[model samples]
Target chain A: MEESNWEPKVIGFLCHWCSYAGADLSGSARLEYPHNIRIIRIPCSGRVDPMFILRALQNGVDGVLVSGCHPGDCHYQSGNFHARRKFAVINRLLKYVGIEPERVQFSWVAASEGPKMAQVIGEFVEGVRKVGPNRLFKDEKKDGE
Target chain B: MENRLKEEAGKLLKEGKVDYIVGYGKGTVNLRTSPLITNKEEDLEGLVINPFIANNLSRYPVELKGRVGIVVKGCDSRSLTSLMQDKKVKREDLIIFGVPCEGVVDLKKLAGQIGAEIDRVTDAEKEGENLTLQVDGSKKTIPFRDVIFDKCYGCEHPTPLEYDMLLGSEVAPNLDIEKSLERIKELEGMDAQERWNYWKEQFSKCIRCYGCRNVCPACFCERCFVDVNMPQWVATYATWQDNLTFQLIRTLHVAGRCSDCGECERACPVGIPLRSLQRKMVEEVKDLFGHEVGIDKDAPPVFSHYEATDPDEFMK
Candidate 1:
């Protein structure tokens, strides 16, 4: 890369029951991971509407990561499963319309899997860095760049 | 078939069986039809089922409060079935008149082929498989397949699957889905940037008219997300970015529910290829869930119910 220090700004939506707690556990353990991600705690990944991801992209976030309980381990019986259906459709659709697939990622991170969460973030940020900035909705008129 | 439909509609109104008869009548313009909604017995004579009846009447029954007798072609019936599946319309509350359709003519193709405006054509008569057009004292003939709507190419249901009375004999589907989806495959063949730019250019022409939303039978939201300004989901302005946002959100919103009716594309005034996005989603939903929309009236909506073994390769 030109600058060699340009880190990607990624937004992580973590479910309160699993992925959020996993982030907490990673912090407690003093894990070594990239600080490029800003986490938003949600009740469940099922609550992450497809609009939220699109808004993040439109708002110019470099990447978006949605993490929740593993299938069948949802806090609300079938929340993750429902979320999976939406994710499947949205991911395919977003990429079909030419958004970089690496810009959005979905993962499962249980409370006990703190190391995995750190590693997931590390890998996701690296992938985002490869894809470069989010220019999908760049408003040249407003930005005046 | 037209006589039988008129007689049955007359009987329905005369016997107070339905509160309204939703069908099509000859529009003032040549080679066009407007939705004909009426409760009077005299209007039955105005009902004309022809090759030019293109508008899907399924969206009407959802709003009409009382008992309704609506006419349906293949795609319109599927849309009705989808609305019924969602409990938006009750079966007992309405009577359905099924018209066995070969395929409706596409006016845009006709205009382009004849190198003239659709309104200029004085008369269009269907003779078996060819259309004889009388344009300014000149008679020109064209095959029916060359001018039919793209959705009609692969229509799976040429007759209503669940109708009280059959207007005519059931016809076979042409099964030329590839012919309709040619544009979609072209888009997919492009690289990410090219595809994005293609849609950007298409959406830039959008004037923010909600014609696509209004005509879509699946877009039956009472309070659409776009109308709500509390959170200000999408900006009201007609900026190209917001237009893209509006269509992207709309396409996602009607993912499984969309029957690929092509009404949204047909309704676009600026000639955006909206059917490509919708038809692509149809392909994805079909591949992802093996679920064809509006096929069965009893099953739960595609997203409401999920299989335990659903594809999870995309997720971590």
Candidate 2:
């Protein structure tokens, strides 16, 4: 299919204390992962409001991944815990609207797991590729030409 | 419905008790009764009370301070109760001429049935079992059972729950609350993912007009969390995420206190079923704490007061 031939545009939000550092380590280790993932570092996972994810999708991004500190390991202690409950709500909302749930991913990535980060991104990119582009929002516009 | 309501308004103006009398008048448009605050007695001629008055005129008591008189129906009186709970208005500062509501006509539904825009429907009469609308161009007869608001269906509480000067016969509260109960029960059966998807579709269409918050009589917060920018809780942008955050926060904030007046649903331009969320939250509050809003002023919020016997399963 023509969709598999094109590289997916994936946006990732990484917590500064853990997930962001993990990405940096992955780069230092010369690990190979899909370059489609564009990482944005935030102070904590709690700072990533549901608005960011919706804005990204509305702007034509194919997928979103929010990675934070492992459970109970947040730099602010309960930041990731709050984030977990919030994302659960957002995930439910997105799926209900007929958008494929595979397009949005949420997982924990500790700072030390550089190889694991690379593997996770690779799997996410593959999953997003299989889902193809989001047609729900795109169809809202007219003018086929 | 009473000569005293108009007489008192004239007396209040002549006695200089108030600056204005906020009441209902014949709508300049078709079929609707619009709210009017008149300082003159001649303007009071348009004032008439019947099943057609649907607005919660008690809301103006807070904003139109310094002594005012408002026409109250049963649901409108709840706004008055909520306003007093928040201390937005003082009881002694105003006069309430409460009317016993048999039921208010749902003008939107009535318009659809009659196939004509209701332009100043005056002289509505209950003839046997049907309501006859006296419109400008034509007289349309609609069944009394049809065109009444769903909230008023089998509603025995047609009289104002509370009033200073009663104007009509007292009405009783209809005991049928099964319809609202059934809707919540149906939603509870959906899986988590299915529920999430359902709400996402509903909330994604939000235009973020903030009409729901503005129209809510209980939502009298000086600085709504959505409007605050110091911490920047929810984004100001009109994205689905921001919209969801705004709705969830508003729903949770009014969980135990929402009166389910259906004002938010009526005010929405997009026709979003806001009552679903508000009613859902109210049902949850009732099931969890056995609390119903607008019942007593002294009772604390459901979340604020927790018993030792409370279930701790949701708590990690």
Give the number of the best model, judged by lDDT. 1
TM-score per model over all chains: 0.98, 0.65
Question: In candidate 2, residue B29 scores what lDDT?
Answer: 63
Model 1 spans with C-alpha error above 4 angstroms:
A1-5, A141-145
Question: Against the hidden true structure, what lDDT does model 2 obtain?
Answer: 0.72
Q: Write the per-residue lDDT of candidate 2 for residues B1-316, one digit (tens) a residue.
A: 5576777778878888877788887676655678888878788777867666766777777777578877888777766765666667777787778888777788787878877666656557777569987776468788976777666753435677767778867866654566535555566677644665666677778888999888877677879988888867777877665676577667666665676777787778877677767776655566555776655545554544544343323221
Local error of candidate 1 at residue A54 (angstroms) = 0.4
lDDT of each: 0.91, 0.72
Candidate 1 per-residue C-alpha lDDT over B40-95 given as tens digits, one digit per residue, 9 for 90 to 100: 99988999988999999998988998999999888888888888888899989879
- Regions of candidate 2 where Cα sits further than 4 Å from its true position: A1-145, B39-42, B120-123, B134-139, B154-156, B180-186, B298-313
Considering summed lDDT, which 10 consecutive residues are worst modelled in model 2 chain B?
B307-316
- Which fraction of the native contacts appears in each prediction? 0.75, 0.03
What's model 2's lDDT at B202?
Answer: 73
What DockQ number belongs to candidate 1?
0.83
